[model samples]
Target: MQQHRCGGGALAFCALTVAGVMAVTAGCSGGSGAGDASGRGERLRAEAAGAGGSAETLRRAADVLAAAGSAEMRTSMETSAGGTRVTIRGRGAYDFRRQLGRVTVVLPKDAAGEEGHRPITELLAPGALYMKNRGAGVPDEKWVRVDTTALEDGNLVTGGVTDPMAAAELLRSARDVTYVGETELAGVTVHHYRGTAHLGRAAGGASARSRGALAAAAKGFSADAVPFDAYLDEDGRLRKVRHRFSFASDGPAVEVVSTMLLYGFGVPVAVRLPAGGDIYTGLIQQGRTGEGGR
Candidate 1:
């Protein structure tokens, strides 16, 4: 990791972005467009095709990732609500060939507000998603495992930038794409691209799926297109990304800004699956019941 470069700033950017938009300035528009959703999608696609530069670069970045066998990344995120803020950061080594890796999250004090500081970690092993919690609140259990055969539907970069593969899919399917400009990141020359994407649609893509952490950074998904920005290194890999969108559950509108960084392409990854002694599966079950405590 000589360059040792990527999305920490992006993650910090995400944290600051979330704080900046803690209060949504506009109303919630969470549907498949107001009218003629499909038709509007087509129009947007046409515009994206005509609007080259940044949009074309996104496709190239995806292509570069598609051929790489593996990579390592550092992911970080911050969320603030009701005057309280939580910061979550992680280090991951992904086996792109296997589409699996382990993400060890560095949870700061009050990272989950009421959840307290927990040294939580996730393992994206084959076919199953597992979590180990060593927090003050967890009761007698250190592991929560999900016997998952298929990935869930959600934003690509949700819950931090654990899965940049989903981000590749987003770049491929984005619309209204534009070139933001060029800048240097981590002392490396990089290009900046911006575009709008529909989270629901991105979820339905053939390659889009949830991974290890169900603790998504995003609160909810909207039918409205969310704004996203990408920073590509000279090698065409994603150095950083920023996604800004709105989610409304039942109360006021809230904005979610997600940023991710990717580097250390083709790095070796080693993951250890926990044993039966670690199994205490209440957390996943609670997540299914919508009372998740991660």
Candidate 2:
């Protein structure tokens, strides 16, 4: 539909398929910026005593989320290659207990400067990813279903939106965790922690729903250690988390930084799985991944 720049390797496949459609059309390149500092200095000092937490605390992030039941989520994924950078963003609600969520992913504008592609609606469930507006020849009314366990990056870096629940579950393997400091997110005070997690270990400890996918990711990525930064509220609920993942392709490895922000705890998230007939089972014209045809 537009002048698409489908690069080479895994990133290429992502571009030719989901990533390309979801890549940001325009935005200034820079950090997300720090939270407000209005009164955090005093608050940070007041909470300094309890700010340093052990890795065990970070490992329990998912459990804390499960207790919260659900939350509204915003996701941002950024990557750079050949000096050009692009970002993909998503927002929606999730039911942690049920391991289900819905996200609307926005892509950049096309060469004509108009909206490049329709926002992709993604359904995130236990082990499957359902997408509408996946545009590669399928009718607009049909949805594409992909088994998360079968994806190379376990759908973490695929679908252009990281699953919020899976992202929290991944912290179960937190190692070498250090308390960075206390910070405020959207006015809520949170403790910041940084660390590296081992995918194999996380897979072993992850819930049954996410185990297979994480295991697949462990084998697919070049390294098992994934670096991350996590922020938790006083009640232990995850306020935000950022994960850096490397996907090795035919060319240089593509680095993907996925950030998830959670808020509006206990939000109602109603999602219905698609019926069989609504799924598009035809070939998708995938370029290099052999993931095209059914």
Candidate 3:
């Protein structure tokens, strides 16, 4: 039987793991340029107004992301617990057309061991989901029949597990886009944008509802709503995304801040599974664990 459990503390660990990988592979910088930098506060206020004006801007961003091809990004995560701070990094690549993607994360040596590691690599080709693991390396070559029906049911947001490119597309569709002035990020000037992300129809069908309900039952399955603050370059490509969330039920709030760096667009990279490594194909099947499910 496929037993899935909440990643719980794993969530924070996952975030940190991604952060660590990103820090090493892709240097984490703040901000981008200074072309339009006269009125900072005014621009931020205006941008916030535009985003608050309507949810359509959020939708458009998601659409643009969906239709786009492949993307490579680096991510960083920081979490605090018991007055201790933990960090991690990750690198990811996605192919929208094929609905296939891979994310590789490197964790801090002292943070946690292999048990805390999360590695996702899959190829949605032919008639099934082809998956392998670099961490475990168990199921060398395994195929789970493509459940398009299930994919359709989980909606776009939750379905991202099987199809991450779709998730990226949904995120891009967020509406009310506006420039929130300029800020210095890692020695570069960046334009910030604040907006709401609308869960498009593609992510709201019956299939999605059912799966979502189950996920919610497992760990207070709440719709992921994030007030995005994105830093972009002059070319309009994203440089950093900063946001926070409190998964706590009734305790001190825990904050999760993740920054993603975009590298190559429409470029494809071959995903290779680790040879002679034990594989854990059940990671994705697990639900949120520990307090996160409370």
User: What TM-score would you give candidate 1 relative to the actual structure?
Assistant: 0.65
TM-score of each: 0.65, 0.82, 0.54
Q: lDDT winner among the candidates? A: 2
Q: Where's the lowest-lDDT run of ten residues in candidate 1?
A: 1-10
Higher lDDT: candidate 1 or 3?
1
What tens digits encode model 1's per-residue C-alpha lDDT throughout 84-139? 44445666767655657788766554333344445567776534556666333345
Candidate 2 vs 3: which has more lDDT = 2
Residue 235 in candidate 2, Cα distance off native in Å = 0.4
Q: Candidate 2: where is the Cα deviation over 4 Å?
A: 1-13, 16-53, 110-115, 285-294
Per residue, candidate 3 scores C-alpha lDDT tens digits across 106-171 of 445545433555453444331223344422324545422223323312212111222343333334
Write one digit per residue (lDDT tens) for candidate 2, span 85-203.
Answer: 55678888899999999999875543113457678899999889898887668789999888878766777777777788789988999988777887777766778888998988988
| Cα misplacement distance, residue 42 of candidate 3 (Å) | 17
Clash total of candidate 1: 2
Q: Which residue segments of model 1 deviate by more than 4 Å?
A: 1-53, 112-116, 125-128, 134-142, 146-162, 208-220, 273-278, 283-294
User: How displaced is residue 293 in candidate 1, in Å?
Assistant: 6.4
